[model samples]
Target chain A: MTDLPIVLRFDDVSVRHSGSHVDAIHGCSLEMKEGEHVALLGLNGSGKTSLLMAAAGLLPHEGTIDVDGIRLENSSLAEVRRRIGFLFSTPEDQLLFPRVLDDVAFSLTTQGRKEGEAREESERMLEAMGVGALANAAPYELSFGQKMRVALSGALVHKPRLLLLDEPSGALDPPGKRALAALFAAHPSAMLIATHDLVFAERCCDRFILLEAGKVVRDTVQIGEITL
Target chain B: MTVPHAHPAHPLARLCGGAILLCGCLVADHTTVAGLIVLPAVALSALLLQRTRLTSMARLMLAGTLFYLPVVVLASPGVALKGLSAAIVGVATVSSLGPQALHDAIIRMPLPALVRLLVLQMVHQAEVLRRESVRIHQALVVRGGVDGIRGIWEFAKAIPVVWLPRVLFRADRVGMAMDMRGYGAIVPAARSVRWRGIDFGVVFGSLGVAVAAVWFSALVLI
Candidate 1:
């Protein structure tokens, strides 16, 4: 058997958006196995979020992103997208549907669900995330924490194989963070979290990778990094 | 009494509300159309009463209305009053909640049927406008700009790139989130929604008023 159980594999990835002088990230490679939780740590401008986005196939970057033997580069995005759950740091940007129900339902519908099925599934997902109460609420009316829950519910609605979170715990309070950590721990899907919130990275992710200049820097986080 | 928190609406409420709003605009008499003035007043009053601390939207709405009045007057003086009244009513009807809930209500309708509405085109106009404005507003929030500016130069600078990333980012997240949610994966199981007595009363009650108004308007004009 191969020595790796990587559910996700990135090789020699480099991304240069249209007219940028320097590539946003260059030559970054990593492997993540099933049930493996990984943290991406870096300061702003360190390319942490960009790398996560690339892995999630949200952006067009030159690299081989393979999820479960499916290479994202040449593979159909529809299929790749179904297998992945992605969230952005900016909750407002992440929540596209104005209505919480519609937003959550968007992911469900994308997976080829009929209207009725999509609605029910969206409701269930919202409930599981403990924000079902806000299911009919307006996106703009929600507080940042509530918005994050809605976004998370939207991400988890389809329950994809790979879960990608970008600083999910940022706007949350301590209790809220812990609640999210517990959810991550209990979730069956493999997770890759991009955050400067080391506390969250420590709690939700089992493995840690510090990214600098679009490259993997120090690999693995120590126990000292764990702080509630 | 403790104040009640705003909640997500029934799909019927959203669908009927939107339909009535649109139809009412097409047919309502001047007064009914004008009931909308109460909408902004209600919004301000509700905000005042609830006393939630956040950025206010009242001034923005006023400014928008003020900016458009002359153009609207110039175009259709007679319909202007009716149109203004109708708009006021529509706005008031939906406030105390936000756009997302109404959208969710729309989604709650059967998918095939909803798709058909868009295919018919006119419904898509309202749909697209809703999508566009919300998308733009979200972008403003994300870019950390567009918070009701005062300075002319700052406003000028903010005009071009205002809320672009937020709009794009929100658009991106919408799809990803929807897919993961498994929306439209299968026929949604039917869920029961019990309308309060008032809700039923509201529906039939509004229908009666609309019918009466239509008949009366036709009779009077003849």
Candidate 2:
């Protein structure tokens, strides 16, 4: 962890949805260093998704978010998005294209990669996710667990510098969870994952940040402070 | 060896065919032309029927006819039958296109990004709602949750209160997801458009039919 670069920073960030009096996230500050694995933990409606979305530039917020030293603003939104891969909580939401391969290759194509190259990379990514055979299959045809794996492949296909995953282990079976743990171990990019699966988090994350009511209530190094 | 047959008409060609027949149905004045439209519509419907839910399509056509009957009859008794026939042809054309083909047509069209996105989302959410509704109804049947008239009423009420909100929420998520992948607000990279010889053929054929229909309707029907 010595002299590692900062990949993501949130400084006094606050977000409020339209017509809502309360901020979804208020005055939050956080940092994720290069190659770091951090777990974001909180109860439902605790602004976990909001934090990740803000980091991904999906949600507009007050204050500053710097991705790889570039401030996240309207002008830099596209560049920021190019640097961070966001995996939604619901796999169905993320898997947009008709076929699994098409969905996985969507980001690559959007980023100006040729179709053939994007498709080859997408196939390789799906192979890593253990769903290579699902390339031709329609997303609607896959089971929930299969969809989750396919969605993960899509998120990682572009190979961004930072990854923001919301509930990475939702609907995964034991084997699928193990594959995900292996993926986290093998992934070279920094990751900030919001998840309820403490057991799975324990296997991959080195730090934990707990949020309560849109505030960071606890931040701990996962080395010796907590078992999960 | 047997002669290699030509590939089936591309989805775009079928889409153009459907559009032409639908337009003809719209402008058709004489019973003969309207009657002629039924053959192609029926042929297309027969081809597409195998790919879709026949029972649902049949039910929808029946409902449409019932709803259109009174208004059509009020205008002219002779036109009532033709109006019903037109409605059936329209339904059959749509049914034959299938959702996937329709999606392909929209994607290939040089439409504005927002319009394309709206159409895509509408189709996706409709499909999702349809599958979920089927599952819900099946569950209701298995659990004996719906009985007779009351059950139907309950199901109808459940659609608006439960499923609609769920679909809307899903649509919102899909929108955010699209944004994260560099699709929203940003003009996406252009997909390659391949216009085939068959597409040109279809266009020419459609133009001929359109001109003939207009001439026939003008000189004979009026």
Best model per DockQ: 2
DockQ, cand. 1: 0.20
Q: Score the docking of each candidate (DockQ).
A: 0.20, 0.44
B39: Cα error in model 1, Å: 19
Question: What is each model's TM-score for chain A?
Answer: 0.90, 0.95
lDDT of 1 by residue, A1-228 (tens): 146467788898887666788877789888888877888887777787778777766667886889877888535666777788888786755565546786788677666777688889889888888898988776766788998898888788788788888888997999999989988988888888888887777778778888777777777748364332
Q: Model 1: per-residue lDDT, tens digit, B1-222?
A: 011335344545534544454454457443343333322332343233223233334543565467558857686543554454345444444443334434344445555854633322222233443555655555655565545543334444554576455446555565554343433344323346677765554445445545544444444232
In order of appearance, the predictions have TM-scores of 0.63, 0.83
Model 1 chain A lDDT-worst window of ten: A219-228
Best by TM-score: 2
Fraction of true interface contacts that also occur in model 2 = 0.50
> Model 2, A1-228: lDDT tens per residue?
869999999999999877899998999998889999998888888889999998888788999999999999999888889988888888888776656887788778888888789999999999988899999877777898888888888888898899999998888888878878878977899999998678888788889888888998789985345433
